[model samples]
Target: MTATSRSLSFALKSATVRSSSGHFLRELLANEHLPQDELQARQDHAARAIAEQAMQESPFYRRLYGERGIDPRILDDPRRWAELPILDRATVKAHSGEFATPEAVGRGVRTALTGGSTGEPLRTLHDARVPSLALAWRMYSWWGIQPYDDLARIGRWSFGRMDAVKNTIAWWPTRQLSLDAAVISEETMTEFHRAVTRVRPRLLEGYVGALLELADFLERRGLRIPGPTAVATTAAPLTAPVRARLEDAFEAPVHDEYRGSEFGWMAGECDRQDGLHIFSDVRRIEVVDADGRPAPPGEEGDLVITDLRNRVFPMLRYRNGDRGILRERSCPCGRSLPLMEPPQGRTIDVLHLPSGASLAHRLTALFSAHPESVRLFQIHQQADASLTIRVVPGPGERSRRHVEDAVEDLRTRIRHEVPVRIEYVESLPYTGGKTKYILSDLPAVVPQAPTPPPDTPSVRA
Candidate 1:
C-alpha cells in the first residue's frame, strides 16, 4: 500500500473505536478525483440513501413526511428532492429527539448544543463522525496539515481535571494544544507566545476573532513566532481585510473555514483562497431564497444543508441560520467541489482573562450574570481587559443589589480580576438585522514601516 493509504488506514482504524463507522477517508480520497458530473451523481445517490434511511429509522422524519401526505420514496427522484419541505431551526428545536434515528437510540451518539440567534439553545445529535473528520482533513491537507500533526487551537477551553484528561487522550494523535480565547490581555498574549514558542506547532487554528486579536497583540509588541506552516480561522465571517491582517501577523497563509456547531466543516478555502469550496459530495448545500427555492448564483440567501452521512439526526434541507452566496464559476485549483462565500452573521467577541479560557467561557460568564429584567444585551471588551454589559431592560426599576449580585456572579465565573460593569440602554446596536452580542475594541490592524535597505544606512530625519 502507498504511504498515504497506509497512514489513512491507521487513522481510520483509530477513529473507528470512537466513530459509528469507518472507511470514510478512502472514499473521501476517491471522491476528490471524481469529475463534477460524477460527483453530483454520487451526491444524489447518497442523498436518496439518507432519505430512505430517515424514513425507515427516524420517527420524526417519517411523521413529518406522512403528515404532508408525501411518500419518502418520492424523494428518490433526483429532481423531486428539492420539492421536500425545508427544515428550519424552530422545527428542530421544538422536536429535538424526534429527529434522531431510532436505531441509534442505545448507541453512544454525539450531542452538540449551539446558542441560537433568539437566545434559545438548539441541540443536535450526530450519528456519523466520518464526514466531519474527513471534510476537515481534506481542507487542512490543502494547507499541508496531515494526520498526527501538531495543531494548536486558541479557543475557550476549561482546564478542569477530568476535562483536561479527556482532552489529552482525545487529542493525543492530533497533538492539539489549546490556548484561551476568552482573554487576550497583555499577560494572556505573553503566555500564548510562550506556549507557541515551546510547542512550535505546524498549524494554528481557532475562532477568527481570537486569532485576529492574537495577531494584533503580537504585531503591536513587535514579536513573531516561527514554524507554523499555516493558520486557519473559523466560527465567524472571514473578510478579505481580516484574512490579510492574519496572514501578515502569522507570516503564513491564512485559510478561512466555514462550519457550525450543528454541521461541522461545511466549506473551506482551497489553496486558491478565492472562496470556500463546499463539500457537495458529502453534503447537499443550497443557497435558497426566502421562498425556499434555489437562489440564483451569486445571490445571497439562507444556507440550507443536508448531511448525507448523519443518520442519527437527519439534517435534510435544514436551514443553518446563516447567509452566503454560491459561486457561479469553478475554483482555479480545479477541485470539483462547489464554491461559496464565507458565511456571514453570528459573531461573538472575546473576553480576556488572566488565566486562559475563552469563547464559551466568557459567554458562560455573561449568560450566568444575565439580569432577569434584561430583554436584550450586548457585551463589549475594553482594551484594559475590562468588560461592559449593555442591556435593554424590561419595564421595571432594577435594584442596585441585583446589579451587584450579577456582577459578582460574573466575577465568580471568570475567576479573575477584571472589572465588570453593567449599563442599561434603551436599545442595542444591530448589524444586518441581528444583534452582534459581543464586540471587541482592540485594534486588529497595525501599520508597518517600510524596511530599510541593508546596504544603505538609516538617515536621521
Candidate 2:
C-alpha cells in the first residue's frame, strides 16, 4: 500500500489495456534494476531466445546458420556468443526480405526505415511497441520521478493527423507535453517556455541543439523557468561543456540519451555523471577495432550491438559504424550494467545561420522521415549561407511528390529565406562507414546572439 507501489500498480494497469510489449512491460521496471548476476542471467536468456527464434523462423538466419552448421544454442552459454558471424549492413541489405519473420509480421509490426550511410534506404521490421518507453521511465526514476509523472519533449515531431489528435484528446490524461522544435527562434522559445513554466513538467527531453538554443534564449533574456526536475538530451552529442551550459540554464540536472530509429534507446546517462549505462538487458554492446577484433582496453573503437529484444528482425552482431569506447569500469552509482562513453558517430555539424539560429535539426532525421524519397543525401553549406542538398533519389513509387515536399519543408524550417537548393546526384560520398551528412565550410563555433524581434515573420517553430 506504499505510494511507490501504488504508482507502479496504476502504471501497470494503464499499460495492461494498450501495451504491445508482448507481456514484457510488466517486468520492465523490476528487471531493469536487478542485481548484476541476475540481470546478466536475464540478458543471456533473452539473447538466446531471440537467436533461437530467429534461426528457426527467419529464412535468412536459418539459411546462414544451417549452411555453416552453427547452432543457435551457443548464445545460451554467453561465452560462445561470439562464434556467430558479425552481421554487416551489406549482408542484411542483400537479404532484407529473408531477415523478416513472416509470422511476426502477420501478428502486427511496423516498418522502420533509414537512409543508411551509403544513401541507400534500409528497412527493419519493428515491433508495434518498444520497451524503451518503459526504460525511459526508469531513467526518470533515477531523478525521483515516477512512471506517471508529467513529462515534456521538445523535438521535431510529426504533427500529422494521429499526433494532432493525441495532442488534444490524450494530452491531459497522458500528462505528456510535446513542444515541437520543427522550427526554432526566440519567438517560438518564448511561447514554449511560457507553456513549460505553466505546466512545469517533471522531466523535459529534447535534442541537444534545440535545448541549447532554448537555453541560450533563456540566458540572454535573463528569464528562468523553474519546476522541471530534469532535462534529457538526445539526437546529438552532449559534451561536457554543453551539458554544463544546459544545467546552468535550466537550473536542473541534464541527462544524455543515445538512441536510434531502428533500435529505440541503447543507453542513457544516469544522474551520477559517470558515463552512460548500456541497457544491457535488452542490448549486447561491443567495441571492436577496425579489423573487427576487440579493441585494446580503454581505446575507442566501433560499437557493434545485438538486439536482444527485436524478434521480428533479429539484429545479431549488427554494426552501424558508430564509434565509442565500451568501458569496463563499474559506475559509481552502483548499477552493475556496463557503462559506455556517448557514441561518437552519426552526429553531424549543425548549420548556423547568420542570424545565429542553429539548425540543430539533423538532416538524416528529416530525410529518414521521407525514406522513399531519399536513398542517400548530403548537405553542403557554402560560406555565403546557401545550402546545396546533394541527393541520391530513392524509389519513385511511394515518394514521387514527397521529395519536393521534403525539400520545401526543409527550406521553410531553415527560415531567413536562406537559399536552399537541390542538386540531383547519382551518389554522394559516404566514407568511413559513416555518412558525412553536412559538409560545412562554416566555422565550428558560432557565438550566441539575440534572436530577431517578435515582429519578424517566422515559419513553423
Q: Write the per-residue lDDT of candidate 2 for residues 274-313, one digit (tens) a residue.
A: 6898989888888888877877547898888888878778
1-461 per-residue lDDT for model 1 (tens digits):
34366467546755676342235655675677789889988898898889888877788888988788767677567888877889876678667768887656554477665544433346687764444676777788888877557678886544777988887676554456777765556677788788788777889988777887777678678988677989988876776667767777888888888877677767889877789988888788888887888998899988899988788788999987788899989887878888888876655445545453443434633432323344556778888768887766544465445555655776776765777888877787766545667676755333343354687665422
Q: Can you tell me which runs of candidate 1 are displaced by over 4 Å?
A: 1-22, 128-131, 157-159, 169-174, 346-348, 351-409, 415-436, 439-461
Model 1 vs. true fold: TM: 0.79
Instruction: Give the least accurate 10-residue stretch of model 2, judged by summed lDDT.
Output: 17-26
Candidate 2 ranges beyond 4 A from true positions: 1-12, 15-26, 115-121, 129-131, 346-348, 354-358, 369-373, 394-405, 412-416, 446-461
Instruction: State how far residue 93 of model 1 sits from its true place (Å).
Output: 1.2
Worst 10 residues of 1 by lDDT: 364-373
Best by TM-score: 2
lDDT of each: 0.71, 0.73
RMSD of 1: 6.4
